[model samples]
Target: MPHLQTVFAAVLLCGAAHAQNMIRGEYWIDQDLGFGANNSFALAQQPDVASIQLPISLNGFSPGVHTIGIRTIDASGHWSLTNFSTAVVTTEPEPPLLTRVEYFLDQDPGFGEGTEVWSGTGTDAPGIGSLPDVSALAPGSHTLFVRTIDSAGHWSLTVHAPIVITAPDVASDIVRVEVFNLTTANDPGFGSAAALTVTEPQINLVEAALWSDDPLSIAQGNTLAVRSMDSNGKWSLTNFFSADVVHTNVADLFTQTGITTYPNPFSEGITVRSEDGQPLRVVLYDPQGKLVHDKVLNGETYIDLGQHASGTYTAFFWKELERIHRVQLVKH
Candidate 1:
């Protein structure tokens, strides 16, 4: 007598007691086959049990065409029907392509004064996708917006990058900050719709950052101005700025993995490393490629390049034989 085995929730069971009368089982091969139906000689006999193995062999069947089925007849002559199984072949389609990439930068109020700063399609280079080189933005906290247009004439969701531009050597404390909404001429005074006052001011007021989660209406722009105010109620010269009013989530701006640099317009060396604390072989090349710097660093390793001249330089982070990341460092 063959032993009994059970299958529940897709798991096989063993060592089950079985004492009952024998029951006959059958299998159907035809697509239209129903209970108490199927091809001839495709039947097996078994005892009354919740689980049983009834194997049968069929010959002279055509290749690439066949459906196997099973059914069991209990001691009461009750038929437990089975579902037909068929092979389904599927070919995965390719994803939509982003034909182009455009970016906008909200720069310092005195420079790059506009909603749009730079736009271009990214290169095919891997790891270094079509991300923009924002070395031109002034040292301070700024917003970068990027979006893509698919080849199907469709537009994907706009993504934003919140970056802080800073210089390492020129560290300063921020005293007070102000915001200006230039979306319309209704407010020409460049007066802040928002402001923050600090008792101690940093060396550079430009390092102060201001943002609003509630974006203004379309066709609206904003400017930020910061200055050190005296206790006697006197205000310093206001450095006005303009920016795009777009709703953005700060979290989405950063990736789960990659290298990050700080002090955008860095005066000294900048910190570089993987998002997840890992070692990276760093390299630096001046615009003309005449000056080069290299090192292996880890999480938050502050690389002081203050000795280098104040200009734009390219930094590369290599993992093994591949250059995992790259960025343009703006040294002030």
Candidate 2:
């Protein structure tokens, strides 16, 4: 008879000897034929040797049936025949999911390039779907989608949900202002309310401005003065009033004085100065406190204001030690 091949029989063996059995195993990718091997051994008295398992690298392995095998090595230095097993692995790529969706208006009224349009959702997997109505887009981009995790921990495929954003029209009555009648009128102040009849156009303009160079703030009981240019480029004050604060854009305050910004109402280039004569560090932020520029100034620093539209900005100056000064700068 053939030499006793006790591999399978050894796998079924019980008691302490079963635990002492040593198993040598190997696996191979069916197509590439790349192979890997590992070995494991248990105490002789342990029963049911089937509990031992081996790990294999499934990466880049094609989806199909693969063969695996294990053998026993006896204390006498004799190798048993291989007892083989097979399994099938599958590889499937899941598409990205649309987790969040939002809608908003754009600034610089009139629908066109640079006008407010729906922005796709934020995701790492893949592209977002196209929006439903292009006409409703304002004069800027709006966040259209958001990525979210599901309960099962698996992300769903991408889905494009419809968004309806109304664009503002060119009209003097786009926004309305009403001053509140306060009993304490002599308090050296006035409270007012601003309302938008044509929300699309008015909101679009504000949203555009907020999204552009700096983020905008909406706070309760705050005054807002809006100036808009229509599709025909006709300039008009759409709304000017003090209302129950809805949003407030806080100006960034920089305490560093080591550097100074020249030309208060700058048109072109503004000079940054340092008092210590050391390399000066400068940073620029919009009213919303977002960093637009960060750099170290060698000698004198020149910043181009032509690219930025007329607006107020915060300039922060610093050095190796600490923040020295922060001041407001205006670009026209």
Which candidate tops TM-score? Answer: 1
Candidate 2 ranges beyond 4 A from true positions: 1-50, 56-63, 77-82, 89-133, 136-158, 165-181, 184-332
Worst 10 residues of 1 by lDDT: 7-16
lDDT of 2 by residue, 1-332 (tens): 11212122123322233334343333333432322234444434222345344454445445666655555454444444555566565655444443333332333222122322233444442433444345655655454432334323443333334444556753543243222213223222222232223344454543322222221222111344444544454645443443242111222221223445677778776887665667655567755656667666776778876766567887645453312344667777
Once superposed on the true structure, which residue ranges of model 1 sit more than 4 Å away at CA? 1-30, 34-46, 51-70, 73-92, 107-131, 167-332
TM-score of 1: 0.27
Native-structure RMSD, model 1: 28.8
Across 238-292, the per-residue lDDT of candidate 1 in tens digits comes to 7655443332221221352355667677777776656777665556776665435
Whole-model alpha-carbon lDDT for candidate 1: 0.49
